[model samples]
Target chain A: MADEKPHCKVVLATNIAKSLLEEVQDGLAKIGRKPLLVGFLSSTDPAARVYAEWTGKTANENGFAFELREIDREELEDALLDANNDAAVDGIIVYYPIFGNRQDQYLQQIVSIDKDVEGLSHRYIFNMYQNIRFLDHANTKKSILPCTPLAVIKILEYLRIYNTILPYGNRLHGRTVTVINRSEVVGRPLAALLANDGACVYSVDINDVQQFTRGEGLRKRRHEVHEKPGWTLENCLPISDVVISGVPGDKYKVPANLLRDGAVCINFSSDRNFSPDVKEKASIYVPAIGKVTIVVLLRNLLRIVQNKIDAAAEASRENVSEAVQTSES
Target chain B: MADEKPHCKVVLATNIAKSLLEEVQDGLAKIGRKPLLVGFLSSTDPAARVYAEWTGKTANENGFAFELREIDREELEDALLDANNDAAVDGIIVYYPIFGNRQDQYLQQIVSIDKDVEGLSHRYIFNMYQNIRFLDHANTKKSILPCTPLAVIKILEYLRIYNTILPYGNRLHGRTVTVINRSEVVGRPLAALLANDGACVYSVDINDVQQFTRGEGLRKRRHEVHEKPGWTLENCLPISDVVISGVPGDKYKVPANLLRDGAVCINFSSDRNFSPDVKEKASIYVPAIGKVTIVVLLRNLLRIVQNKIDAAAEASRENVSEAVQTSES
Candidate 1:
């Protein structure tokens, strides 16, 4: 019986991100210019430094330019404003926890929407939560979703989790997903993204567990939320088709026994959120999603560049029309 | 037994709104000037015209100057721009469903943040969804909440549904609320607001049901979402301590039998969403919240006026310091 026990596949993010990175490289080559991503690092946290280095390396290898600006916490506001004004800087990312409070939130708004590669700015965040897909009335420019959440989405797609035969927005219909972190940047937004795509998303954290779903109706774009009191991992885990964890602590591990058999498990946190034996329960287990996140970040950068180009072209067209009208008049 | 079913207390929104209206009136008097609110009406909908009339009457009664600008749908863009540039206009309201599509959404963005009395502007909506309370770094200016949602919150507070004993921001800590409607302008934002204040909100619409809850930790302000697959009104109603409904169709009724005994019921729809016998199961019932909603709108106008004053003062203070520095140098 022991010899007959099935060994599940362990998937790597690097393998998943390979084709996406190439696609991003192709996108950049077509754009005909290396979009410069300026990253502001004001934190002394070693993890922040390492993440910035990883981003720089990823950007360089993928037909893009990455510049890390190490500045004092006090100078971050000025640096962000400068970057916002600089046409050369196509994207901006700030290493968070600089002030580590509401002040940090204020800092997020300083990066203009046009250059917000991480999609942390209010405009993008608003469009995302509202499930508004495009930036303009004409729907020419696609809205950018936050990198980590978007990466998880891409991973789910690559895994054939999203039913391609279903309508575009309802691809995750009948799917049940449990996201174990509700952090504003990753977990909450990721849940919203999934729910908007027609999944029953259980968003879990230390405080409580909440469920997210898109309301019925073809017109409903944004997801709605409901709270489930006294619900624990014990209740949700066994029912979840996919369990995604991003709890950032070394001591924490998801109990394999609670997970549904053959469930797909994913971890986005820097720390491992599952035991080595998680594969015994999970049909496909992803230990990390960092590489995929970098790819998504670059994809967002290309999107910003494309949006700019589209806007400029629109402006030129408007100007030509104006000139023709003036001459006719 | 039918007679012994018990008569629940009925609360009128007019009585509830009285004190708030007085407070707003006093606020306006203190400001020493009537804040002009310009409303743009392009729709032929009689409901829109009646609402415009109500707004004008309410504004006049509460020391606000209300002007209704009836224009063709084609001219609404120019009208909004004029109102935005006209500093005399302290707040702006546009009767929606003018185009009744994404174009209506485009029109919503035309209302400037500083003067958006409806709080439909992306900035405010984003902040509201994110649970961001203040608009600026200094925390001096309070972010505006959409009037209808804010009205529901106020009614909840008036009914003591919010546990005032708990610390602020966690007032609804143990409450289970079911809101039957996920309309963008009301139900969705209302659910987010309730969950942010610590209620377990079951946001129900025609299509599906969802759960909304704020995560644990004192620092977490925004509410998270989760989807409840196969959940219906029957599943949510009996568990809900409070049932708030805004379904517009007269045919749509929340079956009384499904409601929890002693549940608080409130309706904000033009059409009542509960049956006459709802009072039997309800400990408290509010048939309509339109009066309270108008009061909240005026309150929002006053707030916008106050924000402008504060901004002007800050500007002068900065100028004074700049002048002092110039002299010292």
Candidate 2:
């Protein structure tokens, strides 16, 4: 897999174990309390059930208590509230694609922010995106980011290229990364995260594919002072070092010819956004693997739960100190 | 200005007033109440003070009660809390570019969501972005969006080109639009808004310009099925019908030669991202005229204030009816 192409390497799901273990150890140290996670699965979606089952299995294997509850759409809020109130239930995740339109988000939003390991609440989304927008300097403390994007970041971290500078001063810090889809779940947040890490991210959508052709009217807007001209994918890809795609479909969204040799590609969607022959021309190819994703998801859940426990402990200690001080006074 | 180019049309500050007035009237009918606005400025930033004064002047001219208050950074939270507690103050705006690192956003975040005319709070940011992501189909009602992005939207509405389809089936819906900067105040929010409105948005950062070049190791990960390839600015702008820029520096971020003929360019930045000569090639050139932007900003403030008032009135009525029912029972 590592010798697939001139510079391309293929990473498998098993390669994530070391990183996962490290995360678990860190979480254990930070979280002084046992963690229990409840996965809310609706019977209407078989896919959701499979994902929940996988999560549950992973959770149990990782020394965390995990349970999958079969829930109806109407009972989702009640289930969420119950889990939220249950002291033992440290985290709650409602699986995606509920039967009714908008029902998935509707139920997900009701999950309490503290227990929202999936980061579905508006508060989490806002803080995460704001943190990204402000270059991570914004004071909004985000507990957990969405699983898919976080997983992608973890994958890059595992690759040892996300932050490390190369001998030539090349790194994600100044690299151009194109995200082939703009879905809120994966592409959008991932782009923001990459941008936050100092990668120049260009987002592409298929519906607006027609707008890329060159014509007479095309020109870069110039100011009185001199600056470099703007870019398009046609001009951008020839210089790109990495391409990350999340558009799910049965068509090649990225051509092999567009990529230069030694560039990396990471796909996190159902369909191949890149040409199969891309391996022949690229440095690395990382397809979205469910097993790896689940591990990453579990890692994030544990981290969040541990943070919550630590926060609670710190608050309690502060209260105790306040009471003791009052007595001394 | 109109004759500067064959295709270019320069829209002056006055062109927006008609639409602004129409929006105001419709808002009044929908709001069904008078509104009050408060502008908060820190003494540390001179630019913030000027903007606040302009906003106050516009607010008073538009028949809404407006006040500008200069405050110290330490008093920001207190002032915000006061505005939040004030029942009569329907809208509150904190002038931007607060001195010190991240203090602007910190103070902005303190503004109440109901009175966040500037959309600085995480709640407002999340709701606005989510609203855009869900294409306004999300049930989570948004009280207000970031003023600058909302102003851009209103400008498109005034142009009558945002939603209306062209003879070739091209509209902003399926067109490509490029944003020159990624600032939270304008670029990021505008991209989200445009994406919500169905346009494919490409964000460009001049500081991160080096990343766009194609190099070795570029490849896309493929799935069992295939899809089309992704794009960059070189491919995107040739087909773009509109370009919105918000890079605020003396240097030109976009060159006139990168845009297509007849494409409309809207610059919300102080410096012209587009060259002065771009008027000859583009269909329309809309500069960041202070007067026009102030009007748009005031219009958004008025709309948000009215919405808050209406919501308050509705809540009051519901409470009254509930009280009556309890008495009768």
> What does DockQ give for each predicted structure?
0.01, 0.06
Q: For model 2 chain B, where is the 10-residue window of minimal lDDT?
A: B219-228
Give the C-alpha miss distance for residue A256 in model 1, angstroms.
24
lDDT value, candidate 1, whole model:
0.85
Tens-place lDDT per residue, model 2, A156-186, is: 7676544332111112332456777777787
A286: Cα error in model 2, Å: 0.6
Q: lDDT of each model, Cα atoms only? A: 0.85, 0.63
Q: What are the runs in model 1 whose C-alpha is more than 4 Å off?
A: A1-329, B1-5, B215-220
True C-alpha contacts between chains kept, each model in order: 0.00, 0.14
The segments of candidate 2 whose C-alpha lies over 4 angstroms from its true place after superposition are: A1-5, A29-33, A132-142, A165-171, A209-233, B1-329
The residue-by-residue lDDT of candidate 1 on B11-47, one tens digit each, is 8999889968888978888899989999899998899
Listing candidates in order, what is each one's chain A TM-score?
0.96, 0.82
Interface RMSD of each: 20.6, 16.0
Lowest lDDT 10-residue stretch of candidate 1 chain A: A1-10
